[model samples]
Target: MKQRIAWITDSTAVVPDELREKYDIHVVPLDVIFEDGAYADGIQLSSSELYEKIDHSKTVPKTSQPAIGKFVELYEQLAEDYDCAIAIHLSSQLSGTYNTSKSAAAMSEFPVEFVDSQIVSYPITTLLLKGISLAEQGMDYREIAATLREEASKNENYIVIGKLSQLHKGGRLSNAQLIVGTLLQIKPIFCIRNGVVELFEKVRTEGKAFRRIMDQLDLARGIHKISQVEILHGNVMDKALELKETIKSKYQDIEVLVYPLSPVLGVHGGQGTIALTWTNEPKSS
Candidate 1:
């Protein structure tokens, strides 16, 4: 008998609307909690609304992965219709969403395949889209899982942080380091290395950071065949557009897409952060 497959992702994936509808991807939202209130990502609070609250509030907000109960409920429902489900989530190094989803998957009756994307934002979205495409082509669950794992190993993600204070308060960075960087007016660049965020370098300004990111992209393209490119930012569409144009100009054959970083990711990246993510195209036979 043929198997039916379903796709699941968290809110931070940043997938396009048309693709989501076409693939019938399910999104489980995270929670963003302020001192005065709590909101579900993409459900009760939008990126702009969350940023507005952050700008006005005296304190920074915190984010949490969807509760295990939410995942269990979703999987139970999906199992009712689909024979199995494939769940793609953010990096385990960046968030606990993967673990939560894994636990929920174990509890469900149907066979559910859980993938730790080892990357966040648009990179994660790109990875999931590849898996969804495979599924649409009638690939079985095991074959699809193998393809996703191979594709995920080629991902590279980098972030340009606009403010160190927010990241420090959010616990991603040390306070002492933030103070030292602030004293020197430094802008930090971070990259996902081995599924964890690692400091790549610190530049004197954001412009230099963007230049550094472009330089890295150029280097990677020289080494590998890039399949997709996504530029993500928080409340900075103009700069994102300019950067997108710069990338498009350089790689005329590939189209560069720009999107806002989801509010859950924005909470840690801060308001003005911009991230560049891409994956190598799979080799042809």
Candidate 2:
């Protein structure tokens, strides 16, 4: 009999449900808490429901990583049937999920290989799906983890925010800064580096921000292999689809996925947030 590998990731990953089901991937959800109550992401709270609450709530919703106990419970269960499990999670710099996952792996009786994707949403989901494919092809856990780490190093996440108020309310930005930026209608463009958010540019108008993001994609197209592309949005599906069409017009061969940003992320990203992510083709000397 062939040994089975259990694939796992957090809810922050933007992998589609159908793919998750097909891959037999286990997703441990994070919590999105409102004044009324706390709800498990994707389980009790959906992106649409959570956004509706965000639209009307007096206070902004907060996100929390799953407890260590939850991970322990999952690892124990996976140990029952699978030979081992590989658990990939969001960046440690972005959240404590990677650390929490590591702690749980230590507590598990069976092997649970933990990885810090150093990226979020669609980029992380891309790595998870790739790893799952490798696992299904009979690759060992360590080999799959190593390959993903290498790929993640060459990946990029470019996010464009429609507003900075959510970042302020979430404490990612200071109130004064938010006021200044919003008063001026600033569209913030940022990228993830080494698992931390780094500002790439700040433009005055939405048009410039989108153009800048596309320019970066163009530059990436010049230098990388361009294996995958993802279009992520908080609530702006129309705009996301438009961007997808633009990308398709330029790069017709690459695999493209349109994913909705999770509610946990929407709390800080706010509505109209759109992100583009892709992995670079490995460079050869």
Candidate 3:
């Protein structure tokens, strides 16, 4: 059989409910465990469900990647139908899912192509979606994966962490720092660097943090064309909407999309955090 291509990604894609079935993309679920048993990220639990869990549990829930069986099963099934599978995964710095997928692919009968998105949330999702688009246009698997990685590496993500309390609960910050930052209403903005999450900047107030984020957008667009943009938030539709409008006005021709943050990300940034991701340069094959 001639080689056919298919795309696969993790649940962080936050794929619009409207688009999943239309595309031949697979969204593998992550794992979350609380006081009792464990459940898949979106199959058995949702973001709202995670919020409730966080409220009642004395300790924050733990998260894990999908089992190796999950990836192997998908690989085997897709191998029968397609020439090879291009599996794009979340950053190895953030989770072990990328490595897990790597291990699964080694044992699978089919040749599985895996990529470390090196970015998180919709940034990586955008890369996978774009690759899928190209694949639909008859792009080769290896070419698709390489293009996806190149484009993803040129992307940038900015997070204006709305609350320190959430990071504290998620164990990203210590009690003393969280308490101090929360007391002073300080917000920290983070950026992804070379596959690792790092501290980017800090602001004294939410207003400044948001303004700085917008400023970065302007600067990035000036340097390169902004191909894709996503605004990730918890429940702050108003803030996200405001940011969207600002983006639309400033870059009238750019494509901008917004969606809620996934539970895994929401846990660390807290309810009102706003994360913006966009391509910093044009992607060429």
Candidate 4:
């Protein structure tokens, strides 16, 4: 008999609704806490709504991982029908969601395998979609999980920060650095390395930062074959579309997709932030 596997991911992953429905991928949401109360990311509050609230409020919101009990309940329900589950989440370095999921999985009656994507946003979406394809090709649950973990390492991510205040508030930047960066109009390009977000480069302007991103993409293409690229933004569709057009003009064969960053991510990135991400073509196993 074939083993039945359930696909699970957190709200930070950007799986399309149709794809999620077709693959039966389950998503657990994180919470975004405002001054008044906490709202589940993508549940009670959307990315637009989150931005709107931030615009009106004096304080920036904070995000929290889902409760362990929530995962336990989900596992309990899945235990009835599935043989095992694969839960892919954002980087452990970035959020505690993966660790919380692990604890919940341990308490559940069902077996659960976890993939710490070591990344976030559309890259997580890419990993989950790739795992589903691997499973469809007759790979077992364990093989699929292992494959996803390996693929997670190949994801290349870069972000252009839109607001310096948010990073300072989040403790990613110091008071001195913030003041200098603000004074200089420095737009930093950040990348995920070894599961932690690191400053890749600092350019004097946003336009210069974008040029650096394009240059990075050129270098990546020279080294590896990239099939698809995703441009994610925090309520900045116009800029995302402009970047999409530029990429398309340069690489006609590569597919490009644009998506809104989840509210959980927006809280950290702030409005007008743009993220560019892609995975090198998977090597034959």
Candidate 5:
């Protein structure tokens, strides 16, 4: 008999509602905490609402991973139907969601395979989509999990910080760096390296920063065949659309998508921030 597998991911992964419904993909939401209280990332607080709150508030919000009990409850429920589950989450270095899910899986009677995507946003979406396709092709749960773990490292992202103060508040930047960057009007470009966000370069203006990102894309194309490009923004749809158009004009063969970043991500990236994420085609052994 074919093994029944359940697909699970965190809200940080941008799985469209229709696709999630079609694949029966389950999503566990993270918490976005404001001064007053905490709200579920995509459920209790929409991205637009979160941004609106940020605009009117004096303090930036923080994010928290889902409780281990929540995952345990989910696993117990899935155990009734599915033979096993594959849980994919954002980087372990970035969030405690992966560790929380692992602990929950260990306590449950059901079998759960976890994939630490080592990245976030659209790249995680691409990995989940690929895993779904692999499962549809008759791959077992273990094979699909292993394939996703390997493919996870082949993705890359470049984020352009919109507000320097937000990074400083998140503890990603020092006060000295923030003060200097603010004085110099520097736009810092960051990338995920070894599962942690790191500064890639600093430019004087957003225009120059975008150019640098495109240049990196060009170099990446030479090294690996890119499958998809996603432009994610924090309440900046116009800029994301423009960047999408530019990428489409250059790489007509590659698929491109544009959408708002989740509220949890927006809390860190801040309003007006934009990111470019792409996945490379897997290499043959």
Candidate 6:
């Protein structure tokens, strides 16, 4: 009998809809809760809906991972079809989803290997996409999972907030700084280094921010081999499209794909923000 393998990831991965179905990837949706009500991340608040709601939200939207029981149930069903299952998730430091995934795996009656990605959005999604390709190629589950862990640990999440208004509203940034940024027309540049989001730079305009991000992209490695570039945004279609064009113009050959930032991320990135999700070369390695 041929060996079988299964792939899983959280909603924050920002996977393209067509690829999800094409790869048969199991995407567990995150929970988006408003004071009025709650709904599944992708299913309930489509990308368009998420953006619309974000612009009008007076209160911060809450996010929750899939419960242990839900994880166990999904694992049980998939385990029956596959000889081994590999579950990948966001940073354990950022969210409890990774821990919950591991806990559910331990409780499962079948073999469910959980991987802590330590990265979010496109970086994690890229790892998952690569892992799924390996699995589909008849690689062993352990090999695929180990490769994903290695790649994910080295992935860099470079995010650019076209406006600080969203981060300020979410309380991630102070009101005073937010006001100054607004007056100065500041665009905050950030990147996830060592499992945490760190400020990269502060630009006075959004146009320069785009170039700065692409300049960083040009400096980075590992992206040339990877054909797909994932763009995650919060209520910023025009900005996303413009950035996509910028990427194509500079790279000339590399294709850029945009995916809506899930509600889990919407909590941190305010409306009208652009997050470039891609992997980078380790300075040490």
lDDT of each: 0.84, 0.85, 0.81, 0.91, 0.90, 0.76
Tens digit per residue, CA lDDT, model 2, 131-181: 877877878888998888887788877999955766776677887898888
lDDT per residue for candidate 3 within 7-102, as digits (tens), equals 778886677665677777788888788879887877788877777787887777787888999988888788788878888888888888888887
Better structure of 4 and 6 per TM-score: 4
- lDDT for each residue of candidate 5 in 38-60, tens digit (9 for 90 to 100): 99989999989998898777778
- What are the clash counts of all predictions, listed in order? 0, 1, 0, 0, 0, 0
Q: Could you give candidate 6's per-residue lDDT for residues 1-285 as a string of tens digits?
A: 556767788888877778778867888888888767888878887766765676788866778878788888888788778777788888888888888877777777667677778878777777777777786687877888878778876665567775576666667779889888888888888887767778899887887888887777776743444445778887787878988887887676567888777776876776677888665443453
TM-score, predicted candidate 1 vs. hidden true structure? 0.93
Q: What's the TM for model 6? A: 0.89
Residue 213, candidate 2: Cα error in Å is 0.7
| Cα shift from native, residue 31, model 5 (Å) | 0.2
- What does the lDDT come to for candidate 6? 0.76
Using lDDT as the measure, the top candidate is 4
The residue pairs in collision within model 2 are 225-281
Candidate 1, poorest ten consecutive residues by summed lDDT: 276-285
Best of the two (3, 6) by TM-score: 3
- Candidate 1 wrong stretches, greater than 4 Å: 168-183, 282-285
Q: Which stretches of candidate 6 lie over 4 Å from their true place?
A: 221-227, 280-285
Worst 10 residues of 2 by lDDT: 162-171
